[model samples]
Target: MGRVKHNMVKSLGKRTSSSVSPTDGSKKRSTLQMDLEVLECPICFETLTKPIFQCDDGHLACSSCCPKLSNKCPTCAFPIGHIRCRAMESVLGSISIPCPNAKFGCTDNVSYGLESTHVKECIFSRCSCPALDCDYTGSYRNVCKHYYSYISSRSTPLHHYAFLLYKASSTVRMNISDKIKIHVDYTNELLFVVQCFRESYSVCVTVSCIAPSSAKVGKFSYQLSYTVDGDTMTYESPDMKRILKVSFQTPLEKFMLIPHSSLRGDLLETKLTIKKVIQV
Candidate 1:
Protein backbone atom coordinates (compact mmCIF):
# COMPACT_ATOMS: atom_id res chain seq x y z
CA MET A 1 0.00 0.00 0.00
CA GLY A 2 2.76 2.41 0.94
CA ARG A 3 4.51 1.60 -2.34
CA VAL A 4 1.33 2.35 -4.29
CA LYS A 5 0.90 5.74 -2.61
CA HIS A 6 4.19 7.07 -4.00
CA ASN A 7 3.68 5.53 -7.45
CA MET A 8 7.29 4.41 -7.48
CA VAL A 9 7.02 1.27 -9.58
CA LYS A 10 9.70 -1.43 -9.57
CA SER A 11 8.82 -3.15 -12.81
CA LEU A 12 11.18 -5.14 -15.00
CA GLY A 13 10.96 -5.73 -18.72
CA LYS A 14 11.55 -8.88 -20.80
CA ARG A 15 15.03 -9.52 -22.04
CA THR A 16 15.60 -7.23 -24.99
CA SER A 17 18.23 -7.68 -27.63
CA SER A 18 19.01 -5.88 -30.82
CA SER A 19 21.81 -5.85 -33.36
CA VAL A 20 23.15 -2.37 -33.99
CA SER A 21 26.34 -0.76 -35.11
CA PRO A 22 27.61 2.52 -33.65
CA THR A 23 29.11 5.30 -35.78
CA ASP A 24 32.50 4.00 -34.66
CA GLY A 25 31.42 0.36 -35.18
CA SER A 26 32.44 -0.56 -31.66
CA LYS A 27 30.87 -3.50 -29.81
CA LYS A 28 30.00 -2.86 -26.16
CA ARG A 29 28.50 -5.23 -23.58
CA SER A 30 25.28 -4.36 -21.71
CA THR A 31 25.71 -3.10 -18.15
CA LEU A 32 24.59 -4.96 -14.99
CA GLN A 33 21.52 -2.68 -14.71
CA MET A 34 20.53 -3.66 -18.25
CA ASP A 35 20.95 -7.33 -17.34
CA LEU A 36 18.57 -6.81 -14.38
CA GLU A 37 15.94 -5.25 -16.63
CA VAL A 38 15.96 -8.51 -18.61
CA LEU A 39 14.29 -10.19 -15.63
CA GLU A 40 11.32 -7.80 -15.42
CA CYS A 41 7.78 -9.15 -15.68
CA PRO A 42 6.44 -8.40 -19.17
CA ILE A 43 2.90 -7.90 -17.76
CA CYS A 44 3.49 -5.35 -14.98
CA PHE A 45 7.06 -4.26 -15.78
CA GLU A 46 7.94 -4.93 -12.11
CA THR A 47 10.94 -6.97 -11.10
CA LEU A 48 10.30 -10.72 -10.99
CA THR A 49 9.60 -12.52 -7.69
CA LYS A 50 10.62 -15.94 -6.43
CA PRO A 51 8.72 -19.12 -7.38
CA ILE A 52 8.61 -17.71 -10.88
CA PHE A 53 6.26 -19.60 -13.12
CA GLN A 54 7.05 -20.60 -16.69
CA CYS A 55 5.76 -22.35 -19.78
CA ASP A 56 6.99 -25.80 -20.72
CA ASP A 57 9.16 -24.11 -23.35
CA GLY A 58 10.84 -22.04 -20.54
CA HIS A 59 9.26 -18.58 -21.07
CA LEU A 60 9.00 -16.98 -17.59
CA ALA A 61 6.51 -14.89 -15.62
CA CYS A 62 6.51 -13.89 -11.99
CA SER A 63 4.20 -15.55 -9.47
CA SER A 64 2.05 -12.40 -9.52
CA CYS A 65 1.92 -12.08 -13.29
CA CYS A 66 1.64 -15.81 -13.93
CA PRO A 67 -1.87 -16.09 -12.47
CA LYS A 68 -3.06 -13.28 -14.70
CA LEU A 69 -1.74 -14.92 -17.84
CA SER A 70 -3.65 -17.11 -20.23
CA ASN A 71 -3.15 -20.86 -20.44
CA LYS A 72 -0.71 -20.32 -23.30
CA CYS A 73 2.63 -18.54 -22.91
CA PRO A 74 2.52 -14.98 -24.21
CA THR A 75 6.03 -15.33 -25.62
CA CYS A 76 5.59 -18.74 -27.25
CA ALA A 77 2.44 -20.80 -27.80
CA PHE A 78 3.67 -23.32 -25.23
CA PRO A 79 1.38 -24.73 -22.54
CA ILE A 80 1.72 -22.48 -19.45
CA GLY A 81 0.43 -23.12 -15.95
CA HIS A 82 1.57 -23.10 -12.29
CA ILE A 83 5.03 -24.50 -13.02
CA ARG A 84 7.46 -23.16 -10.37
CA CYS A 85 10.87 -22.07 -11.67
CA ARG A 86 12.92 -23.41 -8.75
CA ALA A 87 16.10 -22.44 -10.54
CA MET A 88 14.94 -18.82 -10.72
CA GLU A 89 13.86 -18.89 -7.07
CA SER A 90 17.33 -20.14 -6.15
CA VAL A 91 18.87 -17.31 -8.15
CA LEU A 92 16.62 -14.82 -6.31
CA GLY A 93 17.65 -16.21 -2.93
CA SER A 94 21.33 -15.69 -3.69
CA ILE A 95 20.85 -11.97 -4.47
CA SER A 96 20.65 -9.20 -1.83
CA ILE A 97 18.31 -6.29 -2.50
CA PRO A 98 17.63 -3.05 -0.71
CA CYS A 99 14.23 -2.36 0.86
CA PRO A 100 11.99 -0.27 -1.42
CA ASN A 101 11.75 2.37 1.30
CA ALA A 102 15.49 2.99 1.25
CA LYS A 103 14.86 6.37 -0.36
CA PHE A 104 12.49 7.19 2.52
CA GLY A 105 15.24 6.67 5.14
CA CYS A 106 15.06 2.92 5.60
CA THR A 107 18.47 1.32 5.27
CA ASP A 108 18.02 -2.42 5.13
CA ASN A 109 19.79 -4.90 2.83
CA VAL A 110 17.52 -7.93 2.72
CA SER A 111 17.86 -11.26 1.01
CA TYR A 112 15.43 -11.74 -1.89
CA GLY A 113 12.96 -13.92 0.05
CA LEU A 114 12.87 -11.52 3.01
CA GLU A 115 12.57 -8.25 1.08
CA SER A 116 8.77 -8.23 1.21
CA THR A 117 8.68 -8.82 4.95
CA HIS A 118 11.19 -6.02 5.58
CA VAL A 119 9.34 -3.47 3.48
CA LYS A 120 6.06 -4.35 5.22
CA GLU A 121 7.52 -3.18 8.51
CA CYS A 122 9.90 -0.47 7.30
CA ILE A 123 10.02 2.17 10.05
CA PHE A 124 10.61 5.09 7.69
CA SER A 125 7.60 4.29 5.55
CA ARG A 126 5.63 7.55 5.23
CA CYS A 127 2.43 8.28 7.16
CA SER A 128 2.40 12.06 7.15
CA CYS A 129 0.72 14.26 9.77
CA PRO A 130 -2.01 16.38 8.15
CA ALA A 131 -3.68 18.45 10.86
CA LEU A 132 -5.61 21.66 10.03
CA ASP A 133 -3.07 24.36 10.93
CA CYS A 134 0.39 22.80 10.65
CA ASP A 135 2.43 20.64 8.27
CA TYR A 136 4.66 17.73 9.23
CA THR A 137 5.28 14.11 8.28
CA GLY A 138 7.19 11.21 9.72
CA SER A 139 7.31 7.42 9.76
CA TYR A 140 4.02 5.51 10.04
CA ARG A 141 4.30 4.85 13.75
CA ASN A 142 5.67 8.32 14.57
CA VAL A 143 3.23 10.52 12.60
CA CYS A 144 0.46 9.35 14.93
CA LYS A 145 2.17 11.26 17.72
CA HIS A 146 1.36 14.82 16.59
CA TYR A 147 -1.73 17.15 16.76
CA TYR A 148 -2.90 20.80 16.89
CA SER A 149 -3.75 23.31 19.71
CA TYR A 150 -6.04 26.26 19.06
CA ILE A 151 -6.24 29.55 20.98
CA SER A 152 -10.02 29.11 21.22
CA SER A 153 -11.85 25.80 21.26
CA ARG A 154 -13.33 27.11 18.03
CA SER A 155 -11.61 29.48 15.56
CA THR A 156 -9.68 32.40 16.99
CA PRO A 157 -11.71 35.57 16.34
CA LEU A 158 -8.53 37.28 15.11
CA HIS A 159 -6.09 36.33 12.29
CA HIS A 160 -2.72 37.00 13.86
CA TYR A 161 -1.23 34.13 15.85
CA ALA A 162 2.01 32.19 16.38
CA PHE A 163 2.63 28.46 15.91
CA LEU A 164 3.95 26.32 18.79
CA LEU A 165 4.46 22.64 19.77
CA TYR A 166 4.23 21.15 23.28
CA LYS A 167 6.08 17.93 24.17
CA ALA A 168 4.34 15.21 26.15
CA SER A 169 7.06 12.63 25.51
CA SER A 170 6.97 12.46 29.33
CA THR A 171 5.51 14.45 32.29
CA VAL A 172 8.19 17.04 31.52
CA ARG A 173 8.34 18.73 28.12
CA MET A 174 10.96 16.65 26.30
CA ASN A 175 11.16 19.32 23.60
CA ILE A 176 9.23 22.40 22.57
CA SER A 177 8.94 23.30 18.90
CA ASP A 178 10.22 26.70 17.83
CA LYS A 179 7.61 29.49 17.78
CA ILE A 180 6.87 30.48 14.18
CA LYS A 181 5.79 34.08 13.56
CA ILE A 182 5.87 35.66 10.11
CA HIS A 183 8.22 38.62 9.84
CA VAL A 184 5.84 41.29 8.59
CA ASP A 185 6.58 44.91 9.56
CA TYR A 186 3.07 46.33 9.83
CA THR A 187 0.70 45.93 12.75
CA ASN A 188 -1.59 42.86 12.77
CA GLU A 189 -2.48 42.97 9.06
CA LEU A 190 -4.46 39.80 9.76
CA LEU A 191 -1.57 37.37 9.21
CA PHE A 192 -0.93 34.49 11.61
CA VAL A 193 -1.02 30.69 12.06
CA VAL A 194 -2.99 28.80 14.67
CA GLN A 195 -1.98 25.65 16.62
CA CYS A 196 -4.67 23.46 18.20
CA PHE A 197 -4.20 20.69 20.78
CA ARG A 198 -6.14 17.48 21.47
CA GLU A 199 -5.17 14.34 23.42
CA SER A 200 -6.57 10.90 24.33
CA TYR A 201 -5.70 8.39 27.06
CA SER A 202 -5.47 5.66 24.40
CA VAL A 203 -4.65 5.48 20.66
CA CYS A 204 -2.75 8.76 20.55
CA VAL A 205 -2.35 10.30 17.07
CA THR A 206 -0.20 13.32 16.26
CA VAL A 207 -1.20 15.82 13.55
CA SER A 208 0.44 18.71 11.70
CA CYS A 209 -1.17 20.41 8.73
CA ILE A 210 0.69 21.57 5.61
CA ALA A 211 -1.15 24.42 3.93
CA PRO A 212 -1.17 24.19 0.16
CA SER A 213 0.55 26.81 -1.95
CA SER A 214 -1.38 30.09 -2.24
CA ALA A 215 -2.35 29.41 -5.86
CA LYS A 216 -3.31 25.81 -5.10
CA VAL A 217 -5.12 26.43 -1.79
CA GLY A 218 -8.90 26.49 -1.96
CA LYS A 219 -11.24 28.55 0.21
CA PHE A 220 -11.61 25.93 2.91
CA SER A 221 -11.38 25.67 6.69
CA TYR A 222 -10.69 22.26 8.30
CA GLN A 223 -11.79 19.80 10.97
CA LEU A 224 -10.02 16.85 12.64
CA SER A 225 -11.47 14.21 14.92
CA TYR A 226 -9.65 11.17 16.29
CA THR A 227 -9.95 8.75 19.21
CA VAL A 228 -6.57 8.09 20.80
CA ASP A 229 -5.34 6.68 24.06
CA GLY A 230 -8.98 5.82 24.90
CA ASP A 231 -9.87 9.50 24.48
CA THR A 232 -11.98 11.13 21.76
CA MET A 233 -11.49 14.69 20.55
CA THR A 234 -12.48 16.87 17.63
CA TYR A 235 -10.81 20.12 16.44
CA GLU A 236 -12.20 22.68 14.01
CA SER A 237 -10.26 25.43 12.24
CA PRO A 238 -11.67 28.84 11.29
CA ASP A 239 -14.20 29.03 8.46
CA MET A 240 -12.87 29.20 4.93
CA LYS A 241 -11.53 32.59 3.92
CA ARG A 242 -9.68 33.29 0.70
CA ILE A 243 -6.31 34.98 0.84
CA LEU A 244 -4.91 37.40 -1.69
CA LYS A 245 -1.49 37.32 -3.41
CA VAL A 246 0.60 37.03 -0.22
CA SER A 247 1.57 33.45 0.75
CA PHE A 248 3.74 31.31 3.01
CA GLN A 249 4.32 27.60 3.72
CA THR A 250 2.23 26.31 6.66
CA PRO A 251 4.26 25.83 9.83
CA LEU A 252 4.27 22.61 11.90
CA GLU A 253 2.89 22.57 15.49
CA LYS A 254 1.95 19.56 17.68
CA PHE A 255 2.36 15.86 18.54
CA MET A 256 1.05 13.10 20.84
CA LEU A 257 2.92 9.82 21.31
CA ILE A 258 1.27 6.50 20.34
CA PRO A 259 2.88 3.10 20.41
CA HIS A 260 2.55 0.86 17.33
CA SER A 261 1.87 -2.33 19.33
CA SER A 262 -1.42 -0.89 20.54
CA LEU A 263 -2.73 -0.43 17.00
CA ARG A 264 -4.82 -3.25 15.48
CA GLY A 265 -3.32 -3.72 12.00
CA ASP A 266 -0.78 -2.14 9.71
CA LEU A 267 -0.45 1.59 10.47
CA LEU A 268 -0.27 2.11 6.73
CA GLU A 269 -3.70 0.47 6.52
CA THR A 270 -5.31 3.18 8.67
CA LYS A 271 -6.96 5.78 6.49
CA LEU A 272 -8.03 9.30 7.50
CA THR A 273 -10.52 11.13 5.36
CA ILE A 274 -10.57 14.91 4.97
CA LYS A 275 -14.03 16.29 4.26
CA LYS A 276 -14.70 19.76 2.87
CA VAL A 277 -17.47 20.98 5.20
CA ILE A 278 -19.62 23.63 3.49
CA GLN A 279 -22.19 26.12 4.87
CA VAL A 280 -24.77 27.93 2.79
Candidate 2:
Protein backbone atom coordinates (compact mmCIF):
# COMPACT_ATOMS: atom_id res chain seq x y z
CA MET A 1 0.00 0.00 0.00
CA GLY A 2 1.80 3.09 -1.27
CA ARG A 3 0.76 6.61 -0.34
CA VAL A 4 -0.93 8.57 -3.13
CA LYS A 5 -1.16 12.23 -2.14
CA HIS A 6 -3.03 14.28 -4.70
CA ASN A 7 -2.16 17.82 -5.64
CA MET A 8 -5.75 19.03 -5.35
CA VAL A 9 -7.13 18.49 -1.84
CA LYS A 10 -10.75 17.33 -1.85
CA SER A 11 -13.21 17.66 1.07
CA LEU A 12 -12.87 17.33 4.86
CA GLY A 13 -12.96 13.56 4.88
CA LYS A 14 -11.04 13.27 1.62
CA ARG A 15 -7.51 11.75 1.76
CA THR A 16 -4.14 12.50 0.18
CA SER A 17 -1.01 10.40 -0.16
CA SER A 18 1.69 12.98 0.51
CA SER A 19 4.41 12.39 3.07
CA VAL A 20 5.03 13.94 6.48
CA SER A 21 7.83 13.10 8.92
CA PRO A 22 8.06 13.78 12.64
CA THR A 23 8.81 11.82 15.82
CA ASP A 24 7.62 12.49 19.36
CA GLY A 25 6.22 10.55 22.32
CA SER A 26 6.82 9.46 25.97
CA LYS A 27 5.04 12.65 27.02
CA LYS A 28 1.43 13.64 27.64
CA ARG A 29 -0.94 13.02 24.74
CA SER A 30 -2.40 16.21 23.42
CA THR A 31 -6.12 16.75 22.90
CA LEU A 32 -5.41 16.35 19.19
CA GLN A 33 -4.11 12.88 19.95
CA MET A 34 -7.31 11.88 21.69
CA ASP A 35 -9.44 13.67 19.12
CA LEU A 36 -7.76 11.70 16.39
CA GLU A 37 -10.10 8.89 17.30
CA VAL A 38 -12.75 10.70 15.28
CA LEU A 39 -10.76 9.87 12.17
CA GLU A 40 -11.36 6.15 12.65
CA CYS A 41 -13.42 4.27 10.11
CA PRO A 42 -16.88 3.90 11.60
CA ILE A 43 -17.25 0.36 10.25
CA CYS A 44 -14.11 -1.24 11.75
CA PHE A 45 -13.27 1.54 14.20
CA GLU A 46 -9.64 1.42 13.07
CA THR A 47 -7.64 4.41 12.02
CA LEU A 48 -8.32 5.18 8.39
CA THR A 49 -5.90 3.66 5.91
CA LYS A 50 -4.79 5.36 2.69
CA PRO A 51 -7.28 6.44 0.03
CA ILE A 52 -9.76 7.46 2.71
CA PHE A 53 -13.26 7.84 1.33
CA GLN A 54 -16.15 10.13 2.24
CA CYS A 55 -19.79 10.79 1.43
CA ASP A 56 -21.26 14.05 0.06
CA ASP A 57 -21.50 15.33 3.65
CA GLY A 58 -17.90 14.35 4.49
CA HIS A 59 -18.40 11.14 6.48
CA LEU A 60 -15.09 9.24 6.50
CA ALA A 61 -14.49 5.52 5.93
CA CYS A 62 -11.54 3.31 5.18
CA SER A 63 -10.91 2.15 1.63
CA SER A 64 -11.63 -1.45 2.61
CA CYS A 65 -15.02 -0.68 4.18
CA CYS A 66 -16.06 1.76 1.49
CA PRO A 67 -16.84 -0.80 -1.19
CA LYS A 68 -18.87 -2.81 1.29
CA LEU A 69 -21.10 0.19 2.05
CA SER A 70 -23.35 -0.35 -0.99
CA ASN A 71 -22.58 3.17 -2.18
CA LYS A 72 -24.10 4.73 0.95
CA CYS A 73 -22.38 6.47 3.82
CA PRO A 74 -23.13 5.04 7.25
CA THR A 75 -23.12 8.42 8.96
CA CYS A 76 -25.20 10.59 6.64
CA ALA A 77 -27.08 7.86 4.78
CA PHE A 78 -25.98 9.58 1.58
CA PRO A 79 -24.79 7.96 -1.63
CA ILE A 80 -20.99 7.63 -1.37
CA GLY A 81 -18.38 6.86 -3.99
CA HIS A 82 -15.23 8.20 -5.70
CA ILE A 83 -14.50 11.00 -3.20
CA ARG A 84 -11.30 11.02 -1.06
CA CYS A 85 -10.93 12.58 2.41
CA ARG A 86 -8.02 14.90 1.74
CA ALA A 87 -8.60 17.29 4.67
CA MET A 88 -8.60 14.57 7.30
CA GLU A 89 -5.48 13.02 5.79
CA SER A 90 -3.61 16.31 6.00
CA VAL A 91 -4.56 16.62 9.66
CA LEU A 92 -3.39 13.10 10.33
CA GLY A 93 -0.05 13.81 8.64
CA SER A 94 0.61 16.72 10.96
CA ILE A 95 0.32 14.54 14.08
CA SER A 96 3.35 12.78 15.58
CA ILE A 97 2.84 9.92 17.98
CA PRO A 98 4.64 6.89 19.35
CA CYS A 99 4.37 3.55 17.66
CA PRO A 100 1.56 1.49 19.17
CA ASN A 101 4.21 -1.09 20.12
CA ALA A 102 6.25 1.43 22.11
CA LYS A 103 5.66 -0.52 25.31
CA PHE A 104 7.29 -3.55 23.68
CA GLY A 105 10.72 -1.84 23.46
CA CYS A 106 9.98 0.14 20.28
CA THR A 107 11.58 3.54 20.68
CA ASP A 108 10.17 4.98 17.48
CA ASN A 109 7.85 8.00 17.51
CA VAL A 110 6.93 8.58 13.91
CA SER A 111 4.56 10.92 12.09
CA TYR A 112 0.99 9.76 11.53
CA GLY A 113 1.40 10.16 7.77
CA LEU A 114 3.50 7.03 7.60
CA GLU A 115 2.13 5.33 10.73
CA SER A 116 0.21 2.60 8.95
CA THR A 117 3.05 1.87 6.56
CA HIS A 118 5.55 1.75 9.41
CA VAL A 119 3.34 -0.45 11.55
CA LYS A 120 2.82 -2.90 8.72
CA GLU A 121 6.56 -3.65 8.88
CA CYS A 122 7.40 -2.46 12.37
CA ILE A 123 10.04 -4.56 14.12
CA PHE A 124 8.49 -3.73 17.48
CA SER A 125 5.16 -5.19 16.48
CA ARG A 126 4.55 -8.48 18.32
CA CYS A 127 3.46 -11.63 16.52
CA SER A 128 2.46 -15.07 17.81
CA CYS A 129 4.37 -18.31 17.30
CA PRO A 130 2.56 -21.15 15.50
CA ALA A 131 2.95 -23.45 18.54
CA LEU A 132 -0.29 -24.75 19.98
CA ASP A 133 -1.11 -23.81 23.59
CA CYS A 134 1.55 -21.14 23.51
CA ASP A 135 0.98 -17.44 24.22
CA TYR A 136 4.37 -16.12 23.28
CA THR A 137 4.10 -12.82 21.32
CA GLY A 138 6.99 -10.54 20.54
CA SER A 139 9.12 -9.13 17.77
CA TYR A 140 10.54 -11.49 15.14
CA ARG A 141 13.88 -11.27 16.95
CA ASN A 142 12.38 -12.41 20.23
CA VAL A 143 10.38 -15.12 18.49
CA CYS A 144 13.62 -16.53 17.06
CA LYS A 145 15.26 -16.49 20.47
CA HIS A 146 12.30 -18.19 22.11
CA TYR A 147 11.87 -20.74 19.32
CA TYR A 148 15.51 -21.86 19.37
CA SER A 149 15.62 -22.00 23.15
CA TYR A 150 12.43 -24.06 23.38
CA ILE A 151 13.25 -26.50 20.54
CA SER A 152 16.81 -27.19 21.74
CA SER A 153 15.65 -27.92 25.28
CA ARG A 154 13.53 -30.89 24.07
CA SER A 155 14.67 -32.05 20.63
CA THR A 156 14.56 -35.54 19.10
CA PRO A 157 16.77 -37.39 16.63
CA LEU A 158 15.71 -37.05 12.99
CA HIS A 159 17.41 -40.30 12.02
CA HIS A 160 14.97 -42.19 14.22
CA TYR A 161 11.85 -40.77 12.49
CA ALA A 162 12.29 -40.10 8.80
CA PHE A 163 9.59 -37.91 7.17
CA LEU A 164 8.79 -36.25 3.86
CA LEU A 165 10.45 -32.96 3.09
CA TYR A 166 9.05 -30.17 0.95
CA LYS A 167 12.36 -28.44 0.19
CA ALA A 168 15.18 -30.55 1.46
CA SER A 169 17.84 -28.27 0.04
CA SER A 170 17.27 -25.24 2.29
CA THR A 171 15.82 -27.30 5.15
CA VAL A 172 18.79 -28.38 7.18
CA ARG A 173 18.14 -30.99 9.84
CA MET A 174 19.69 -29.54 12.99
CA ASN A 175 20.13 -31.47 16.23
CA ILE A 176 20.36 -30.38 19.83
CA SER A 177 21.64 -33.56 21.50
CA ASP A 178 18.45 -35.65 21.11
CA LYS A 179 16.36 -32.76 19.73
CA ILE A 180 15.91 -32.16 16.02
CA LYS A 181 14.14 -29.47 13.94
CA ILE A 182 13.66 -29.18 10.18
CA HIS A 183 11.55 -26.85 8.06
CA VAL A 184 9.23 -28.19 5.38
CA ASP A 185 6.41 -26.95 3.16
CA TYR A 186 3.61 -28.62 1.20
CA THR A 187 1.65 -27.41 -1.75
CA ASN A 188 -1.61 -28.87 -0.45
CA GLU A 189 -1.09 -30.26 3.04
CA LEU A 190 -0.91 -28.96 6.57
CA LEU A 191 2.64 -28.45 7.88
CA PHE A 192 3.38 -29.27 11.49
CA VAL A 193 6.06 -27.49 13.53
CA VAL A 194 7.07 -29.06 16.83
CA GLN A 195 7.88 -26.27 19.24
CA CYS A 196 9.30 -26.56 22.76
CA PHE A 197 9.42 -23.91 25.46
CA ARG A 198 11.49 -24.10 28.65
CA GLU A 199 10.12 -22.43 31.77
CA SER A 200 12.42 -22.55 34.78
CA TYR A 201 13.00 -26.34 34.82
CA SER A 202 9.76 -27.57 33.18
CA VAL A 203 9.40 -27.93 29.40
CA CYS A 204 6.26 -27.30 27.32
CA VAL A 205 5.61 -28.90 23.95
CA THR A 206 3.55 -27.43 21.11
CA VAL A 207 2.64 -29.08 17.81
CA SER A 208 1.98 -26.18 15.47
CA CYS A 209 -0.02 -26.64 12.28
CA ILE A 210 1.35 -23.96 10.03
CA ALA A 211 -1.26 -22.32 7.83
CA PRO A 212 -3.18 -19.12 7.27
CA SER A 213 -5.70 -17.79 9.77
CA SER A 214 -8.56 -18.06 7.30
CA ALA A 215 -7.85 -21.76 6.73
CA LYS A 216 -10.73 -24.01 7.82
CA VAL A 217 -8.95 -26.56 9.95
CA GLY A 218 -10.47 -29.17 12.23
CA LYS A 219 -9.76 -29.54 15.94
CA PHE A 220 -6.58 -31.44 16.93
CA SER A 221 -4.60 -32.57 19.97
CA TYR A 222 -0.99 -32.95 21.16
CA GLN A 223 0.57 -34.91 24.03
CA LEU A 224 3.76 -34.57 26.12
CA SER A 225 5.14 -36.93 28.75
CA TYR A 226 8.14 -36.87 31.09
CA THR A 227 8.87 -38.20 34.59
CA VAL A 228 10.48 -36.34 37.49
CA ASP A 229 11.64 -37.55 40.93
CA GLY A 230 9.30 -40.57 41.20
CA ASP A 231 6.10 -39.09 39.77
CA THR A 232 5.07 -39.21 36.14
CA MET A 233 3.92 -35.93 34.56
CA THR A 234 1.89 -35.84 31.40
CA TYR A 235 0.04 -32.97 29.71
CA GLU A 236 -2.27 -32.99 26.73
CA SER A 237 -4.68 -30.59 25.10
CA PRO A 238 -7.29 -30.78 22.34
CA ASP A 239 -8.66 -28.13 19.92
CA MET A 240 -5.36 -27.30 18.22
CA LYS A 241 -6.13 -25.16 15.17
CA ARG A 242 -4.05 -25.43 12.02
CA ILE A 243 -3.09 -21.82 12.44
CA LEU A 244 -2.49 -19.54 15.43
CA LYS A 245 -3.38 -15.85 15.01
CA VAL A 246 -2.79 -14.00 18.25
CA SER A 247 -2.90 -16.43 21.21
CA PHE A 248 -2.22 -20.14 21.71
CA GLN A 249 -4.63 -23.06 22.07
CA THR A 250 -3.30 -23.38 25.64
CA PRO A 251 -1.43 -21.13 28.03
CA LEU A 252 2.38 -21.36 27.90
CA GLU A 253 3.66 -20.06 31.26
CA LYS A 254 1.74 -22.36 33.62
CA PHE A 255 0.78 -25.30 31.36
CA MET A 256 3.86 -27.51 31.80
CA LEU A 257 6.37 -25.61 33.90
CA ILE A 258 8.08 -28.53 35.63
CA PRO A 259 10.94 -28.81 38.07
CA HIS A 260 14.48 -29.00 36.70
CA SER A 261 15.62 -31.77 39.09
CA SER A 262 12.80 -34.12 38.07
CA LEU A 263 14.41 -35.32 34.83
CA ARG A 264 16.01 -38.80 34.94
CA GLY A 265 19.03 -37.31 33.24
CA ASP A 266 20.07 -33.75 32.37
CA LEU A 267 18.31 -34.31 29.02
CA LEU A 268 14.50 -34.36 28.98
CA GLU A 269 12.94 -36.48 26.21
CA THR A 270 9.42 -35.59 25.04
CA LYS A 271 7.03 -36.96 22.42
CA LEU A 272 4.35 -35.13 20.40
CA THR A 273 1.66 -36.19 17.93
CA ILE A 274 -1.18 -34.32 16.21
CA LYS A 275 -4.53 -35.61 14.85
CA LYS A 276 -7.47 -33.69 13.44
CA VAL A 277 -10.87 -34.66 14.83
CA ILE A 278 -13.46 -35.62 12.27
CA GLN A 279 -17.23 -35.33 12.54
CA VAL A 280 -19.63 -37.60 10.75
Whole-model Cα lDDT per candidate?
0.42, 0.51
Model 1 lDDT per residue over 162-271, tens place: 32221111111111122221211122112212222222432333332233223222223434444546764454444333222112333233323334444443221111
Superposed Cα deviation of residue 158, candidate 1 (Å): 17
Which structure among the candidates has the greatest TM-score? 2
**Given candidate 1, what's the lDDT at residue 228?**
45
**Residue 260, model 1: Cα distance from true site in angstroms:** 32
Model 2, stretches more than 4 Å misplaced?
1-33, 111-120, 127-130, 138-142, 155-280
Please give each candidate's TM-score: 0.39, 0.42
Error of 2 at 118 (Å): 2.9
Model 2 Cα lDDT, one tens digit per residue, 138-200 = 654455455445545666522222233422212223232323242333223344555444556
